[model samples]
Target: MNKATLASALGSPSAFGQSQFAFMRGNAFEARVKADGGAELLRLVHERLDPEAPPPKGGAVPDLGASGPEGRTARTALALREATGTGGWTLLDHPLLALDVAGSPAFLEPDAVVVHPDGSWTVVEIKSFPMLDGSADAAKVGAAARQSAVYVLALEQVAAHVDPAPRVRHTVLLVCPKDFSNLPTASAVDVRKQRSVTRRQLERLTRIEEIADSLPEGTCFAPDLPPDRLTAAVESVPATYAPECLSACELAFHCRDRARAQDAVTSLGRSLRAELGGLTTVGSVLAAARGESGDPDDPAVAALRRAAALRSEALGGVAAPRAAAEAVPCP
Candidate 1:
């Protein structure tokens, strides 16, 4: 895998991993995908493969770095231009396949890898942080480390085929901005903590790999749609979860519309919980209100019993005058 391509692959996976299942609804996502391009006769096949969505790309992205993202590439290119003078970093972009924690594919693509004359490789994950602080954002640093770990995994599988049997070590170079709000920094990156953070990620991901290998197919924690299905929907696309929704899910709008028609008491467990207090679905709430008790200590049962007592006092054949003390609002 080349640098740019590796970036695309590793880039989106981190954010998209949790949403895999939601994205599996083929028809909707497919429509969303193909809506980008034209000639959509059967194109919107974002989820599963049914001749609706197009095939997935061989890999993710590869050109983002070259475009001077955050000035990382420009700086790296300049450094290479100076270091090699006539030549650039041997591997400007490349992908490595290290097993993910689940033994599924965890990949890495570096902006550049400094291949030494001695055949040792120093991996660089360029950053855009400014040089002034000599510090890195803890969250951003963690993400880079995790991303780099995937590359470390990928290279283990595919590096030997290259010309040099480069001694691969987990090295990351973070390129940052000279100033926070200023032009992007393509050049300077802090590497002091790269190895420490990266080591932890490797350990974590490998555990994931072990667990994945242990499970059978069709198990939880596996991709909602198989890799093949993902590939199928590359160009065709599908209906998105939903644009105006909270999670950006394709069905979010639909669910919201459905929710508006019913009160929480008549809806799901959570809704009842919200409306009637904890564990207060319609059945349980009604049961309590009727004084048909379950466990006396149960809050639901108690609340219902209390309401029943109040109603009986007020609605008995001869109603007593209102309790001059206070008023009870109608539920």
Candidate 2:
């Protein structure tokens, strides 16, 4: 069963939901950006990333029609190979690329991928956020960059199989509304660091088959099962929960409840959990802070003790204020 269904069965459905208005607005913005054979989008790419190349003129918008994801992925690969040998601009809209993730194939459809005149490819990300004074929210930009990096990685996989592999640029084009207006603006964001990090993290994931083999016999996650049985089945699979999971995972609430019940330090944040070293529980952290336990030679324990001492001294030195009349001098 999917995490959402499991969560609903456990009476802990996800709290995060997108508003209809925001959804509609995003769709409209993307349409405008990709309208007219992606003329405006192509122009932006030429202006920002490939200024020395000739301006794009009615670039080829190949027909990527196919029945299913598999068909579409094959069609997209064919179109990309055909476009690579040419010497003109080509915009591939919603191309499906297959990436091998942890010994499994995962399909990804990027907003668009542009084939440059020099046979280089650039990923494009369209967002509804407003870019004020040529700048958008840093957090949103970072998120978009990370997402685009995944697409780049997928594109690279396709490139590797080609006779003459095309270069997938590390920089992606981000399109957004300009200064609270509907007018589109573009920016070039370098995602080399994000790509490297994502590639490393994905490489580190354990194969799904190995994880499944380790599970107990007959450990089913069917939502129709009784609540206790379903919960037990879920708990059988160990999970590393962090605060960021609330946004990305459907079972985050259930995991959060479990973490809090166990006084797990990860319920606070991943960074704090990493900094705490061997202290995996909030009780251990508190005990260390109070000087009741933990080795003094440990850096985490030593820092906690120093902070506790400073807090106590600050609280002890706090003096009571005088009466208002006494301070005012009868003025």
Candidate 3:
């Protein structure tokens, strides 16, 4: 069975799963865009990303099909090398590329990889999000840019294998529906910053060997393990919980529950944690606000005390100190 099935069996929410409605909609939109041999897709890339470059003239979509991800990745690398030598427009649909992340290969599949006439490649990311009045949601666009950055990083690995390494453009093409219509519109998003950040983070990640060494001997993460044993095994490993994990991690809810149970101030949010100084727990922060136990000289504690006093005064000065402390917002 796949990882998702194992996760479901283990009572862990599927992080990679999406709603059927959204999944179907996105798939249909992408299929429509890529119909007609991706003619519209090429036009958008030419018009939006590289207008100066000649329009994709009779591009070829080489068949790079293979049974598994590894074989497909190899085929994609071979196609890229050939495309570079030809110096002609070539579009690779759903091509697989692999990047070494934390000493492991992370395979990525971009919507399309367009090999330009200049031997440079562009990563294309297609989304169903509409561009209303030439403006799309900034947050969604940012997410697409980050995703494209990952594809770019993976492409660079392939480029390294080619003689006279071809360039992987930092600017990617983001294609979306135009103004609530199914017609495609494209925008060039520069992902230099995102690419650098992702590269650095991936490079700096702790190796799996170190983590395994730290775990107790005979520990296993098999999904079929009993609930109690699984919970204990999970708890044995350390986790750095933050608000961002909610959208990205399957175990985020579990970690948040643990944090809340332990009174960790970080359970609320990272921003709140930063302002709490030495007060790392919700209970400690509340105690400091109530002036029960904290270094009065610390700016964070002093500010909390001042804010608590002002809040009490605003409430007609009738609120008891403990009650006023409890009313202080942790957000």
> Which numbered prediction scores highest in TM-score against the true structure?
3
- lDDT agreement with native, every candidate: 0.41, 0.89, 0.85
The better-scoring model by TM-score among 2 and 3 is: 3
Q: Where does candidate 1 stray beyond 4 Å?
A: 1-89, 94-101, 159-165, 180-331
Ranking by TM-score: 3, 2, 1
lDDT of 2: 0.89
lDDT of 1 by residue, 262-284 (tens): 33242343433443555333444
lDDT per residue for candidate 2 within 87-127, as digits (tens), equals 99999998999998889888999999999999999999999
In model 1, what is the error at residue 255, expressed in angstroms? Answer: 15
What is the TM-score (0 to 1) of candidate 2? 0.92
Stretches of model 3 off by over 4 angstroms after superposition: 1-12, 320-323, 326-331
Task: Indicate which candidate wins on lDDT.
Answer: 2
Model 2 root mean square deviation, Cα atoms: 6.5
Return the TM-score for candidate 1, rounded to 2 decimals: 0.33
